[model samples]
Target chain A: MKRIAKLSTLSVLVLIMVFVAACGKSGNNNNNASPSPKASEAAAAPAAESAAASESSQPADKKVVLGFAQVGAESGWRSANTKSIQESAATAGFDLKFSDAQQKQENQIKAIRSYIQQKVDVIAFSPVVESGWDTVLKEAKEAGIPVILTDRAVDSEDTSLYKTFIGSDFVEEGRKAGQWLVDQYKDASGEVNIVELQGTTGSAPANDRKSGFLDVITSNPNLKIIASQTGDFTRAKGKEVMQAFLQANKKIDVLYAHNDDMALGAIQAIEAAGLKPGVDIKIISVDGVHDGIQAASEGKINFIVECNPLLGPQLMTAVNDVLAGKDIPLRIVTEEGTFTSEQALAALPNRQY
Target chain B: MNRMFRHHLFWPLAILAALLLFNLFYSPDFFNIVMRNGHMYGSLIDILNFGAPLVLVAIGMTLVIATKGIDLSVGSIVAIAGALACLTISRGTDQNALSLVLSAVGLTVGLSFFLGAWNGFLVATTGIQPIIATLILMVAGRGIAQLITSGQIITVTSDTYNYIGNGALAALPFSIFIVAAIYLIVSLLTRKTALGLFIESVGCNPQASRLIGIRSRLIIITVYMFCGLCAGIAGLILSSNVASADGNNAGLWYELDAILAVVIGGTSLNGGRFYLTGTVIGALIIQTLTTTIYMIGVPPEITLVVKAFVVLTVCLIQSEVFRKKVVQRWKTRRYPAEREVSRHV
Candidate 1:
């Protein structure tokens, strides 16, 4: 019994250590811990936004608190976007009240309500889904808090619910990806058998990217998509799906991935089959994350359409503009750049996210 | 030799053989392996190399199921192990140092042991159901892993770490050697000693075994710990293969596959009469099915549907009642009177 007790104690100790190490690691990287009860940062958000726009603004000493509810850490791009928002909030001297939805609609709604309860000047959130937000938006409006949508848009049809939607146009992003492919093979004499690795089965990206690409390519008689499958926006699945495509089809010329991560995975699959990725299979991908940029520069991925995640400055700017009693546009699209092999080398150095 | 032919492993091996023959019909070059950069490159090699993780997890799962317990926590432990190992090595200035890689590996195994012990402790002392107890870690482990990696894919560039995942020796993947070594250790510990008997005895009749002076509690705890250890190694292989740790998707739903492998290997969830070889063949069948789906160009959504049908077919074939019903039909119609006379004699 004594020996068993001793063993159990040792095991507990090991578990504790593992947890401590884990917590300490993330805590170090997590720049913005939970917001404090008392706002100490002077001129939180509005004041900072005014500073960037104008040389002088009245009552700069008062703090502007902005509450931002984010969709949880679902992907690498989401994480990078979170980091950007947090950093921007701090730099803009805004007391930011941040909440993570963890990819749940209920959690996000709860967060929005909590932000309203706190009586923050403005409420901002990236809705996990497009529908079922009319009630929450109405609640925010009743609370006299303006809302700003970032990265993704809600399908509420009521544009009055938000002051402005500050993110990339999904349909446009998909069209950009397709346009590059059409330009590449306009003079193609043979059929371009393209295999697409889609995102999550029915997500916005998957739906829009598919339509966007098809809208452009379907018009061309020579361009045909032989197989379209969902890799679930994962690298492993991308490789598996690509491998299967290789087996069933004797000749596959073009590969289109909804995201850079999937494209990278397909590259590995293509290489394992004793063929060069960018050379033999003309690859086109989106997102333009660091890995995708580097892959493009290395000639592994052929072309990349950029979908920028750093919406901090734009989101903050819109909130300030609204608070200043100025009319802001309903849709504000951030400028994004595309990359080829030549352009990748020039842009790879500055591509942080 | 006759007894060997009648072993439980015989059927699982036969199933694997049938799958391989089916594969041959699809692609003639399925069995071919060519020497490519000192490593064998072909469909057969890929099946074994990729199936290595499943084999390791199923080996541990076999014992757990044999003891009438299941470790759903193995999948979570895989994520945790991969996350921590990558963090440890990535944090270090010298990722190439052999010492750094070894320590990282050691830390991952140690962490896995603790997770396993936790499950064992909850089930043995606290009397929580095995599924529910392990399920706690299964859910929490992914969140913990996410916290460790800070919700980002931690990609590391170290040849030493990569060697475990991508390195090949003697024209085979390093993962195969690692699985073999672990399997040898486990079998030797069981067969060469009285450990296997005690575990089986306890699993069969815990009250009787305890009355006979067998430590049933210790056996249960030990098996769960072993399962955790196996998961830790699998986690390492998975992360190393991609050279990154993805908390959300790393080893996602792998526990289901391991459970399926154990069940398909003919190990009863009711406990007793476990066969490691059977589990190995079961793991291969699962891997081959995945390989076949890709080879045949099945739609992504239909992949799961096809897998479910295959599993159903295998389980039906293994049913004793089904087999007896079919056999009894022939006898009942052709030799009903002769059967009655033989029974009486």
Candidate 2:
């Protein structure tokens, strides 16, 4: 029994190695270390030379193998982001190997290491967190594989490790929302009592969004946030918190939510309170999701600052540019636009996500 | 009156009352109920409305806990039930059609029963531990829900379905009526029949109950099925309230909340004795505390810490043994001579 157990364990380990090797070969067959014991029939030295020769013979025609790792599908915005990355990769005709890290830093690190071992042309990932990535990224840098950061950034001081970062600026998105609000209430005289529905506390987006909005709104002392509470960035919690806000304050002039879902939820609460949402209390929110834009077009949400999730096209372009040895900037911010109720109606037809 | 004070539900009720009283003092308008469009609107009503799903889940959890079983899968079941219902409604040409809405609800409830049976079978027949059995579904059920919704949030524009959550009847939110009805039925089913006794007997000792000719396995399965049914209804209310089903976020952490509600209601983890009324009050206390936090404008950073503190205080207050020990310690500290005399005696 002991011998059998040992044999089984050894076989399992072998199986895992083979699986990893095959996954690498599928992404790019140029890796010389991928031929497992099962593929020992071929002479190792000659196989390596032929593979290297084929690779050198037609390097330009070779499909640029790209490994992109993503955080898990935790929300609609994430799903949209994932869809865009996937669809645009197909459209761009890059040999793409995707991994979902399931919102775990360790998983993302494991995936990045695997991509490095597989030796895909480039490695791109949205870091689950800012820190604890120096070691793996160092390994990638030593391997001479250019890494690209998307959606989020790493906290490493060694900026040279990554070729470029492509994503929306969350603080900028928040500033846009606040900027629109300030411009709207510019000519108005009375104190604009705003009830703010924040996202999950301590989250990067939530904290940055709050600061950016506060920074912009500080220009107008008349714009005061009466109540600021975290709705945890969900529709139900947003509705429930908005209900409490409505009950606590008799007069609320504006509602600013961190995201569209919360803004949509607050619209329901506003209506239930026998007050018009866009008319009685102007609403400003971030993330131009379909549902939020629909609400905006209907004049329920006054304005929306879009935190665009469609980073695929720009990311593909950057990947191509990096492969071509072009010096791309360290930071490439995706083009995002703000939407009014009127603009929302016009953009509703062409909205992809 | 003395017996009322000693009632199993007394502590949970008192805690709820204290929380409400605190709210009344802190925010006098918390109790303000006004008739708007022939429907009641107030912070108090909001508690019952928003809390309706939790109340339903806890009511089911009360019985499951009585059988010495924990349903950690309730949260996942909530997500699945809502996802399936929304997916069905979204597929229909007319989302608002009553038939479509009814069928969606029926399908969701039916699937929940099957999921519950899966848990029950694993526990009762296969002899798996309850926690481990439910944990399988707890993890896998969310994936199943995600599959049902194709990993996307499904939004349905169905008013008839929305009525289950947002509509009011007789100047009260319709969700309150659904909760009250379920509570009534559960109370009657347990108190009026031998089923409750059988459950307690099985909970107390499975082998002994089997020797005594009790169908212990059936009892376990029945309670889990009933719990699933309750979770399914809760999922419906939650999805209906938002008019959308979020497979990822809907009913997240609900199982822990329901279990907390059950524990707060004086239900023992060891099983046997349970109080449905206590569970209801416990759910209300939780909802009331959340509302209080928002009304008082607790800083978002320390909100969780404040909630943990309140929950801990309530749990300590609920323990009679803890109370006696504290009181005895206080008496000893206040009078050293009395302690010496008692020691001599």
Candidate 3:
């Protein structure tokens, strides 16, 4: 009995340690520690980097250390964004300390605090949520570390907390989708019936996207959204909900999915229901993910509003300007484009995500 | 009549029927089944097709609950199994090859068994609470899945693999046949042998059963392993249906749904008697509610609220005490003088 008890206790301890280690490793990538300051600075001697990097670096000996805390890899878009940031940081010859928050605001906050303690030259983070970040941003400000917001913004009233915010406007993407649909049906006579597949309810993207689309489509009374449902930003839910939508309604003129994944799922449902997706019911979707772009090129979807995940090159420029004592805009929106089948076909070969 | 009413499955089936009837009233064509391209298509067919995963998971959950244990890690297992399978298939040169699809599926199920064994080891051997033991995997399993898929959705184009989720057999969904086979096999395994009685005995009093020479610990582990196997199969169907496996979103909240199905099926959470058929009915009710909500065109924002109310009504109806109280109140309201006279007599 005593031996068994001892063994079990030892095993439990081992298991607990394993879990803690896994939790720590899964979120927050601290792998690129840059092998001490001297070696990285020596290796980063090439002045043939980005234009901003070449101009900002006067002394090759001193390397700018940047700490970036990213939201977890929840979707394809998020992972692409993370990749861009990491690659851009490497190209700019900045010592980047990257942390994955695993979709937790508390983890992001902790990462930022650690960066502050380390006295990094600059701090950048794509916050997991908009609210409850004022305190953490305030701490970074007091610590004399300038902060940059990427992909998402904090809800703090103070403008000085983050030097600049960089991301695609979700609402603007929605408006672009609505505008494209309006343009498509401008010359037509009959009312165009639309069914909306929304993202997770109450999420910033879902609320903003819905509002933006409504803001645009309400102008033209010819376009009507007969039914709307949340797919929780997932493909399976998208197909399931779309099936019901098809069964309930006899005719669906258009489908506006909050993201590409849902749109793809809806396309499958449409095909299964014996209707050609782009021809029978026009599909307008946001998020120019590779899969979404491919669908557009295939003529399965009619229009797509690009929500670009590649913000790294632009973010690097902003960081360089900040270090060079050059003033930058407070809200730096990434330039995004809309894609039709023709444009999508031409852009398919060059698509990254 | 009383015995039939008192059966464990009675309230669950009634509730499911009531839900279906409500849908029929709400939409006249709710029960219409049409054949299109050799496949059955309708709201009813969809409930069965979509609810197959939940039913499979709940069947295994019923057995685990019968052995007085809860498997909270089933959702994570579902995600892990799908991620592993999709990753394997995607790496193969010919995704459509029968050998590759089989190997991928075999590897997924094998991994699930190992994961289940780990949970069983912790719970049965170390005497950890079932909830706590499984919660470890529930938290870490998604991360492991993400690692397997490299944080990207792995989409596969294998017709063979898609057959499990989308292909029709005999004018009905192939998923329904899978659910039926599993249900039959599980029922036979538990009922045909002494396994069912032993499970109930262990659940009733583990110490007494062990003292009586029953291997309670082995039974607990076996039940959990079975649960893992069921989750793995469910994972396969889910990923195959979408032709992609999303490590982050696949099988999210499935464990809760399975547990709810078990509870609503009239299986006591305290653990003793189990009802496999009732659990199936419970799963159907849930799927039906979701479909009804969509068919009724309930606003997207309040969809959850509507679902919660329907589930609450089902649970309330399943409670014997609640039913008796309701019936007694109706009797008293209708016959106040008769009640007083009977009391005096």
Candidate 4:
């Protein structure tokens, strides 16, 4: 009995240690090991002191202290967004305190409260979801921390909760994808059979993208969507669902996927079925992810509308404007472009993510 | 022969028939099959091919539930198995080597088996509840899978490997063949040996079975191991079908589907009786339901509502007490009205 007790105790301790180590690993994304909870506090204490010192000594050129709460690295696009934000923060010389929300809205809310306590100059977060953020944004407002929404938007009725939203217009991105398809198949002699691979069902991107695509294609009598199913924005489900679509329908001309991942998955299904993807079954997907661009360059995807995740520079510029007592726009849309195979090939060499 | 009609298999079979009949209303060509280049192509074929993975997992799950145990980690085990298999093939020196793919599969299955044994050890030896014991792995398994895939979806392309998932055999999808093989092997092994009787006895009363010289602990461990092996095979089929492994979504919520399959197949959570046939039918019903959803154009968002209603209907039909009550209510209503009319006459 004593042996079992001792073993259990040792195991618990080991688990705690492993958890702390994992935290340190993710926390050290900037190459500095904040090592322990106390270490972070110690580092923050000196910064706070220096901040007070700079208040009296240097007023005009004080480095803005920015706290960023990011949704976790669920996909390549998300990680790219995080990297861009972190890099731009470094170049902009902002004291960036980053927190990974791990795809949970509660974690983002908690991180925001902590940033408020830390009295950071600006707060930025790419919300995990669209709702349930009114209270936290209000708290940040009360704390005098201007909030910036990056990569995703919030559904708060109080528009003043966020200073500005700097991200690609998801609906526009979907419209571009649909318009490309409509232009290509406009002169088709017969009905063009189209299949759709959607992102996660009920998600913002999935719903908006579907609506936008539908709006454009609704006017075209020749284009008909034979089937539409949720791929859940994952590669495995995309392939499985695409395989079924192929089996169910004898003829399929176009596949409009909501995202690059699902499109990539469908490419495999098309190849497995002994048909060329971009040529035989034309594909137009949103999100210019690196793999998707590479696939476009290889002619596996016909067109890819860009939903640029590089919102860093724009986000930082908004932060600077807010901190310098300058008025910024309530909505800042990032400029993105659609790409062809040639453009994809030319841009693939310089793709960062 | 008359008494045989009252068996549990009757209800599940009836539900399956009704579902098939319902599919015809939406999909006029639901039963159509064509030979395209010596390969079967049809919606009906898709149901069988896609449901094969679920059938394999549910067979193992039925056995576990028969032992009065639940294995919640089956989905996570699936993710891990697929991740490891894809990782090996993607990083292999000779990418298309049959030997490499075969060995990778073997290794993935073995590791999953070990994980199942770990769950069994906690439940059987440590005296933890089965749910909690398996929950430990269910929560950590995806993270482990992510670690193996290096936090990215690992995609591989190998003709030899892809054959396990997307290949056709005699005008049918290869996945259906895999399920048939697994079902035959498990049923034969369980029926031929004393294993089935032993498992039933243990499930009926673990303490009495232990007194009667049945090693309940060993039986529990064996079922979990079997369940893990089944999930590993499912993972392989799924990842092969897509030619990619995603730790997060590979088998998400499949454990629930498996449990639903077992319960809907007439295997009680209270333990004792087991039915592989019922489980197979249950898996078919589920796959058919998914196809029906798409065919009916239920809209992807509201499909679950329809699935839930169908599941509830099946459950109600399965309950003999509920059926008896319904019959009684009909008799009382009709007979009383008839009696009043006769009295008036």
DockQ of 1: 0.33
Clash counts per candidate, in order, are: 3, 0, 2, 0
C-alpha lDDT score of every prediction, in listed order? 0.83, 0.86, 0.86, 0.83
Model 3, A1-353: lDDT tens per residue?
99988787788769877986876575435433322354234334332255346345547777789999987766677767776776667778778888777667788899999999999989999876567888888999999999998877667899999899988787888888888888888887898899999987656678778999999999889899999999977789999999999988888999999988899899988987878999999999988888889999999989999888878778877888887778999999988999999999999986776
TM-score, predicted candidate 3 vs. hidden true structure: 0.90
Q: What's the lDDT for residue B106 in model 2?
A: 92
Query: TM-score for each prediction?
Result: 0.83, 0.87, 0.90, 0.86
Docking band of candidate 4: acceptable
Estimate, for each residue in A1-353, the C-alpha lDDT of model 2 and write its tens digit: 97886677568656855985675455433222232333232233223443343344336577778899987665677777776666556556667888777567888999999999999999999986677889999999999999999987777898999999998888898888889889989998999999899876655677778889999999999999999999877788899999999999988999999989888888888889888999999999988998889999999999998887867767777777787788999999888899999999999986756
Ranking by lDDT: 3, 2, 4, 1
Tens-place lDDT digits, model 2, residues B1-345: 979978898889889989989988988888889988888999999999999999999999989899888899999999999999999999999988999999999999999998888788678866789999999889777767776776678888989999999999999999999999999998998999988898888889989999999989899999999899999999999999989898878898999999999899988989988889989988988999999999889989899999999999999999999999998998877767988999999
Q: Going through the candidates in order, state the TM-score of chain A alone for each one.
A: 0.83, 0.76, 0.82, 0.83
What does candidate 4's lDDT look like per residue over B262-320, in tens digits? 99898999898899999999989998888777666566778788899999998999988
Model 4: residue A213 alpha-carbon error in angstroms:
2.5
Highest-TM-score candidate? 3
Model 1 lDDT tens row, A1-353: 97898788768757876986787557755546543223214224433664475323325677688999998765677777887787667666677888777667899999999999999998888877667899989999888899998987788877788888888877787888889888988999999999999877545677788898899887778999898888877776787678667766769999999988888778877876778999999999988888888889999888888888877867767767887889988889988888898899899886667
Q: How many backbone clashes does candidate 4 have?
A: 0
Would you list the rank order by TM-score, best first?
3, 2, 4, 1
lDDT for A49 in candidate 1 is 61
Between candidates 1 and 2, name the one with more favorable lDDT: 2
Candidate 4 root-mean-square deviation in Å: 5.6
Docking class of 2: acceptable
